[model samples]
Target: MFSHHGHGHGQYQPPATGPQHEPTFKIFCRADEGYCLTVRHDAVHWYKDMRHSTRVKDEEGHPAFALVNRATGLAVKHSLGQSHPVKLVPYNPEYQDESVLWTESKDVGHGFRCIRMVNNIYLNLDAFHGDKSHGGVHDGTTVVLWEWCKGDNQCWKILPWGPEAYAPPPPPAYGHQAYPPPPPNREPGHGYHPAPAFYPPQPPPSHDEPGYGYHPPPGGPPGAGYGNRLPRALASEPTVRILCRADEAYSLTVRNGAVCLAPTNPRDDFQHWVKDMRHSTSIKDEEGYPAFALVNKATGEAIKHSLGQSHPVRLVPYNPEYLDESVLWTESKDVGHGFRCVRMVNNIYLNFDAFHGDKDHGGVHDGTTVVLWEWCKGDNQRWKILPWFCFWRDEYCSGLILYYSTMRCSRPLPPALLPPPLPLPPLAAKAVEVVPKRSERIAAKMALEALEGPIHAVSRAQRNLMRKLGLVPERGPVTAEAIAAYNALFSKPLSQEHIIALSSLFSGSLPPGKAAEALVVCG
Candidate 1:
C-alpha cells in the first residue's frame, strides 16, 4: 500500500538488489529522454541535466557514480577514482565534500522519487510548463531547491554502467528456422476445438503464480497428459530475436491477456521466447504437419488461439490436459525468401495486419475482427525463430533470460560481492594524477567558510572537493545555524586543536594545495 500523508512521502523497494561493493551506476531521469544526474560546478547540489556518454568510462575517464552506505538506508554517492575522497558526490572528482545522500522515498510504478537525506528535501528538475524546452538542466536552465513534492523530475531510473544497460547491436540476417516435428506416435489429424464458454470463471491473480494475468482456456500447463519427461534437445537454444520475412522484427509480447506481435528493440527481454519440447503440446494437422505453442519466457504461457469472436490468438497459462486446438500451429516454408508461415487452426494464416498503428508499443487486436486472414504470403504472414547461445561451455545452450539482453555478464561480480574465500584485492596505484584545477580550490573555500561557523569542524579531504569551485570568503559573516548544519553532517567531529589549526590556516589565506596538507596533521 502507498501513503499520501505527510508531504506524500512513500516507501518503496528497489526493483533489483544492488551489488555488495556498491558498484558505480548512471542514474537517468525519466522525465527527460537522455539526461543524466550530474553535479554542478558548486558541487553542493545535483541535477539530472547532463548529456551522458555510452563509453566504458565518462569523458573524464572515471567510473560513474556509485551507491554507497547501503546499510544506512541512505544512497550515498561515491566516485571510483583512487584520489577521490570518501564522501558522497557525483562522478566529478574535482570537488569533494560531505557528499549528498538521498533516499528512494516513493515508488510510483513507472518511476520513483528521491529525497535528499542531508536536508530531508526532494530533488527536483524544473519543468518548463511540462515542456522540456531547455529546462532546469545545465543548458543555462534553472535548477531550484524545493520541498518534497514527488514531481516528475524527482523520479529516476538508476541503471548499472555496462553493456547490460546498452541497446543491442545490429541484428543478424533474417534466417528462417523451424523446430523438427515430434517423433512418430503423435496421432495425426487436426480439427478446431469447440468454442469455450464466454468469460469462463477466472481465478484471482496472484504474484506467486508464474503467469497470473494470462491463462489458457480450460486453464493449465501444456501436455498435462504428456508424461513429465523433460526433452533435453528442445531447451538448447539460448537468447535470440525472431525475424519476420518482411524485414520487421516479430515477437510474442503481452497483449490483452495473451501474447501477440508487438514492436521489438534490442533491449526488450520479453522478445526472448522458449520452446519446451518435452512438455510442449504438439498437434498434427490433417496433412500430418506438426505445430507447437510458442511459450513466453517470463511466464510459461503459450501462444493460444481463442475461439471467441475474431478467432483471436493470445498467451494462456499452459495446460497440457486442456487439449486446446487453438493453441497449436503448423510451420511450413511459405513461398517467400527467409520466411516461414504459421498455419492456424482454421487453416487461415496468422496475421498482424489490422493492428499496425501501435506497433512500437503493444496493444490488443480488434477482438478477433482481423486476427486471421487468408494466407497471402505477405510480410505479416511469415515468421522466423532465432536461438539463444550459451556463454560458458557453449554446450547445453538452453533458455535466455526474459528481461535482459545477451547472456554476457553486465559486469564481473566485485570481489567484495563474492564469498569469503575470495577476498577483495587491494586497489592498485593510479597511473596518472588527475587533479581538480578550479573546482577543488573553490570547494576548499566553501568547506573553510562552513568550518568558520560555530560548528568549527572541517576535514582535509572535504575541503579538497571545493578547492577549484571558488576562493574562500573572508573569515566573517558565519552564523550559528550554518555552523550547526555543517557539524551535524560530519560523521567524525573535529577536535578543538583541529579547529584552531584550520582557523589559522584560513587566516593566512595560504595556497589551497598546501593548506589542505597542513590541516591533515592538525588533528
Candidate 2:
C-alpha cells in the first residue's frame, strides 16, 4: 500500500500507482446527529444524509470497494458539464461517468480522515454545517470545498460497520434482456390488422377552490396573465449578471468611447442590461426572432458596435435613426448560461475578448473589449440579457398584496381561522318561521358539505324564487342576524372591499356574507 501527502485540498493528487481499491467503511461526523455521507440516485455528489448502515454492499452481507479510477484516482462528482465544488456519490456500474473514482486519505490531522475526489478537491463541510445557508440543519445539504485542514465539520471518522451488518445486494437478471426485439409489423393490406394506439387516462381537474367542481367553468380569480403582467413574467423579470461559461461575472460599462467587460462586484449595476424588443429595425425579425437593444439601466444607453468601424463598440444615447441596423442585436441560440448576441449590421457576433493593447482608443488593459467577431461558441461571446421588474425601470407594481388578498384564502388552515358557514334555509329568507331550528342546523351541515359553485349565482336563484312568493324581508337585518340578513337579500353582493373581514371566515375567495344561504339552495 502507498500513500501520497503534503498537498492542499484543491491541489492534492493521488499517487499514480495503477488502480487502487478503497476499503469499504461507513463515514460519520456527529454520530448523535445520525447523518452519514450518502450518494444521490444519479451517483453524482454525496450529501450529509443517509444513515451509517445504508452504504454500498454486496450479497452475503459484505462491504463493496470504491474502485478508484486509474487515471484520476478521484470519486463521484456533482458537476459534470459545469465547473463546481467536487462532491461524492455512490459508484454506478452503468453510465460510469468521470466521477466514479475516490481515495481515502490517511489521517490528515486532528485525528480525522478525508475523502478526496478525482479533481483534487477534498470533501469539505468546514465552511458550512448543513445549516440555514443551505436550507437549515438537515440531511442531504451540500458538502462544500476548502483547503485541507481537519477541524470541526471538516474532520470525519471512517468506522468499519462489519460485513455482518451489510444488506444483501438484489439479484441481477439472468435470462431476460432489457432491449428485447420489437414485435414484427404486419404488411399493409394483408390478412392482419394493426391495433389502435393506446393513450393513458388523464387526472381529474384540481378542486382546491369553491368553483373548482365539474361545472360553472371552475371559477376563481383570473390567471396571473389576466393581471396585465403586474409583477411581469421572466421576460419582464429583474436583471441579473447571468454568470457566463467562463464562470466570471462580466460587467458591461462604457469608458473612453467603447463598451468594456470588467470583473463585476456582487450586484454591479453596470452589468445590468435590459433586452428591449419594443423597437426593432426590421419588421421581418419581429416574430420569435426579434431584433432588440441591450439597454443599460444605469447609464440609459444602448450598446453600439458601430457598423464597419475598427473601433471598439461604445455605449451611446439611443437614437431612433442609428437604431436602423447598427444598434439592434439579435439573440441567437441559448448557450447554456446565456444567449449569443449577434450584431445585426454585419452578421458578426459580439465578444468580450482580452484586450492586449490593440491601440483602439476605447480599450482597457485588464478589462475586456466588445469586439464584433465571428461566433466561435466561446464563453465571452455569450451575453445574458436580464429582465427588470421594478416600477422604477417600468411602470409595474409588485401586486404582492393583491395576490395574498385574493389567493391566500384558498390555502388550507386550522379550524379556528375558518368557522363553518351559518345554517339558514331559503324559507328562512322570509319573516315566517316554519321549519324547526334543529332541522335547519342539520340541513346547513349538509349544504356546506355539498355546495361547489360561485356564491353569487346561487344567491341570485334563491332571491328570485323568494320574490315570486312575495316573501321579501322588511328592512334591517333579516332572519334575526347579520349572516341570515345578508343571505336573505341576494341583491346585496359582497365585492373586493369585504376581503379583509371575509378572509378570516373562508379559505378560498372571500365567501359572500350570504354565501351560507347560497349553500342551502345548492345542496
Candidate 3:
C-alpha cells in the first residue's frame, strides 16, 4: 500500500538490474492513466496511442543516465533554469553535459519514480494554463521542469518498452475462429495465444475533440499569427532573419556592404536572407549541424568573413564555384527558445559587442556593429533565427483559405474578398510616390559605375541587361560558367536597350558597333 501523507522520498533504484546492458522502457504518467511520454517532431508531448521507447545509459563516474529517445535518436535535455520545457537534442557522449543527463529518485508509490535533474527540480507535466488546481495530464500537454510537490503528475511509472503497452487490445474473443491456431512446432502454451476475454477493447481517444492533442503555444504562432506553420527542419531553403538574443529588436542586417546589428525592419530587403541552395549538397558543419551561406535578398551577396580578428564581416558576390569557406555558417549550442550561436569557420562566433565599461554607456542599442569574436558563452553571441515569411506575410497571401482563393480565382475579387493593402513605412511610402526621371536613372547608373571602379566595373550591369533582353536564362547565379555559356549561344544582334545600356556604361565614347564588340569581349 502507498501512503499520500509523507514527502514521498524513497530509496533510489537503477532502472535496469543487468550490469552489462540497458533496458528500454516507457514512462507513463501516474496522473494520466494511459498516457505515456513521447516526442513528436522533436517537441515533447504525451500521447496515449503513440509512444516512443526510451533507454537509459549510465554515465561514467556519475549517478545519472543519458535518457535517449528511440524515435529521434536524441537525448532528452532541458535548460538550466526552472520551469523550462524539456527538449530533445543531439547527444554528445564526449561532453556529457548536465542538461542531457537525468537521475531517477526512489519509487514514490506503485513503482512510480520521480525523474529529476541534478539541481533537484523534477520532470513535471505542465498544469493547464499553469493552474496547479487542474491536473495537466491531458494528452499533448508539454513536459516541463518544476519543483517536486509530491503530485501524481510528477511521478512516472517505468514499464518495459513495447508496442503492446499502448496498442489497442484485440476484440473480445467469441469462439475458436476468433484467433489463429497455435504454431504446430511450439509447446501447448508457447505461441499465438488468444487475448483474454476479461480484457475489453476500448476505442482510441478521438483526436478531433478540442484540447485533445492540439496545444498551441501561448500568444499564438511566433510572429503575426501565421496559423499552423511547418517546422524549420521541414522547410527547404527557408528564408530567415538572424535576430540577436541580447536585444530582440535588433537583427543581423547588411548596411553599406558591412554586416551589423540594426533595428528589425520587416520591409527592409537587406535583413532577409535565403540559405543558398547551391551548397545544399554539402552543407554540414564540423559538428554535423546544417550550414549554408546567408545570401542577401536585395544585394545578391553572401555574408563572408575576411579571415582575421581585425576584419569586419562583409558581403561579397555569391559564386557557387568559388568554394569559399568564409561564406559558410552554422547554428550550434542551443541556448533555448530557438536561439543558438551563429558560428563561422575556425570556431569564430558572431558576437554583439554590448559590454563597454562598468557603467552602462552604450550596449545592445540600435546600430551596434556585430563582429567575429571568440566564444565567451555570453548571451550577446546567441541569436534567434526566425522565418522571414513570419514578419513579411503582410504583403503576401497566407493561410490555406487565402491560398485557395488566390489559386482558384481568375477574375478580380469582390470588395470583401480583396486583401487589405499592406501598410508601408514613411520612407517606403515616400519612395513609392516619386517617378524616376531619365537623368536620375543615368545618374544612378553612374553611381554604380563609380562604386565598382574599373575592375570588371560594368560586368554585373551588363549581365543584368543581358538577362532582361533574354540573352541569358534567368535560372542560376551569373558566374563565369554562365558567362561562357551565354557567349557560346550569342547569335542575335544587340537590341536598342543593349546599345543604350552600353552607351551609359561608356559615356557614349564608343559607337554602337564598337560597344557591342566590347560587350562580347567583356563577357
Candidate 4:
C-alpha cells in the first residue's frame, strides 16, 4: 500500500485506499470560503483557450474546473503538488456540465458549443451531427466541430492510491465505462432518426438571448470575460525565424583592402516555431511551442496574463473562485476569470467593517484585467464577486442584490458595486431566444393534454372517413401509430374541435384508432 507524499508528479502518490494517510494538497483555496469539491489532483495544469494550451477549448471560453459558493472568482488551480487517491462522491447528482470550449461553427447541446481540437493546435471547426450530412458528413455519421488539438479528449485526470489515500478523484460511475454504446437499433446519423420526416436538429441559437438567432459572442458587455474559446487564426502567418551568426561579410572583405577578420564565432540558427501539445500551467503548451510567453513562475494565480485587446494579457494563473472556465456559461451568466490582489487605502482585506466604497467597483468585463490592489472599504472598495451571491460572503454575484440593498431583491445579484438596482436591458438587441418559460411550458402542457380527447375522436372520424374514401389500412383495430400515419399521410385540418367533431361524426365506425404518438412537449 502506497501513501501520498512530496509534490508534483514525483512525490504526489496516494495510498492504496486500504489504509494510508493521503497527503492533502490545496488544489484551490478561495481565500477562506469553499464549496463543491472533487478528488484533488496534484498536477492539474489549466491553460487559456487562445493560448493554444489545452486542445479542448480556449481557456477564455472553457475552464478546466470551477468552484462556487462562499468563494466567487474564476481561476483554475494548476496542481503542482503530489497525487493522492480519493473516492468519488457516489451519485454526485450535483455534477454540472461546464463548457470546455466554444463552438466556432456550432453549438452542441444545452448552450455548450460543439467543436474538437488536437493538442492545442487548431484543426477543424464543426458542429455535432448525429447521423445526417449537414455540413460534409458521410455514411450518415454525426459530426461535431473538431479541431486537431491534443488533449481535447483527455477530459479527466485519474489518480488512485493503494487502498485509501483519496486525493485526485475519479470520474463519475467509477470502475465502470463512462460512455455506454449507443442503442443497438439506433443508427449513427446527424441524430438518431426513427423514420422519415424527422431530421436530427437545427443549430441551437448561439446565445439564448430572446430571438437573436445565434451570435458568436463579443456580443455582450465589454469585460464579462469569455474563457476557453477556440477561434481560428488567419492564414498567411509567417513560418520563419532569424538566427544570429557573427558574420564578417566575406564578400566585402577583399574590397576593404585592409585585413578584415572573417566571421569566426560559431553561429546559432533559429527555426520556425510550430505549435505542439505540451502540458503546462498558465501557458497551454510549453514543450513544442507556446502561443503566449511561458510562466516564469507558476504560483496559484501568480502566473499567466489575460490576452487583453490584442491577445488579452497572458492568462494569469487562474483561480476558479474568481473566474469561470466555461466561455458560454460565463458569457451567458456574465463573469470573468482571475482576481488581482487590489491594494487599498487601508492596505488590508478581511476588514470590511470599515469597508466604505465598493469591493470591486472596477468592472470585470470580457477582457478586463485585475491584479491584487488595496482600496478603501466603501462602495469604492466593496466589489461584487460572483458564483457567491452573499452581500459580503465571498463576493460571488449571480445577479442577486445584497440583503441590505435599497431595492431589496432576494434573488441572485449580478455585477458588483452597482449604485442602485437599475433594470439591465435584455442581453440581445433583437430578441434573446430562450427555452419556453415556466408559464409557457405549463400552457403548452395543458394544450397537449386537451388534444388527447380530440385526437382520440379524430382517430375514429379518420377511420370512418377513410372507410368512406375506401383508403383505410388493412390492419384492423387501428393503433395510435397507425392513426399517426393516417394523419400525417392525409393532412386534414388539425384543431381540437375539428378532431372531436370528426370523431362524433363517425362514432359508428368499426374500430377506433388513437391519435399521433403522445407528444411530450411542455409547451
**lDDT values for all models:** 0.35, 0.36, 0.46, 0.22
Error of 3 at 466 (Å): 50
Clash count of each predicted structure = 40, 13, 0, 154
Give the candidates in order of TM-score, highest first: 3, 1, 2, 4
lDDT of 3 by residue, 1-523 (tens): 1111111111212223432124455566677655556664211211111111132222211145556553334666543223546665554343324445566676689888777653223344332232346745555666776667777777776565443323333453466222233245633211112322211112223342211233333554544322222223322455677776566656676665567777766556567777664554555654666656777655456666432233355555555554554467777867763467776632333432323311244457666666655566666767766664341143232332233223233443576765565443332233234422222211111011111112122234445544543444575333222332343333234334443445544465655445545665643
Candidate 1 structure, TM-score to reference: 0.29
Cα lDDT tens digits, model 1, 1-523, are: 0111111001111224332223334554445535544332211112221122122222123222323222122224321111112232123212111123233444655755443322112223222222344343332233333334445654556655453322232333369322233235532111111223311113325543433443332455545322122123333434445545443433445444554555443334355665533323434543455656565555545565432223345555555444444355566655553356665532333443323323342323322122444455456556655553222122111111111111122343455533233211111001011222322221221121211112132333333332311222234233222222232322244444434334444455666456545555542
| Model 2 ranges off by over 4 Å | 1-243, 266-268, 280-288, 307-311, 320-323, 345-366, 388-523
Per-model TM-score on C-alpha atoms:
0.29, 0.26, 0.30, 0.15
Clash pairs, candidate 3, are none
Candidate 3 weakest ten by summed lDDT: 443-452
- lDDT at 248 for candidate 3? 60
lDDT of 4 at 202: 24
Best candidate per lDDT, number? 3
Where model 1 places Cα greater than 4 Å from the true spot, the runs are 1-240, 263-269, 278-282, 308-311, 320-323, 345-354, 357-370, 389-523
> Model 2: per-residue lDDT, tens digit, 352-403?
3333323333323335666554555555555554432222222121122122
What's the residue-level lDDT of 18 in candidate 1?
30
Predicted structure with the largest TM-score when compared to the true one: 3
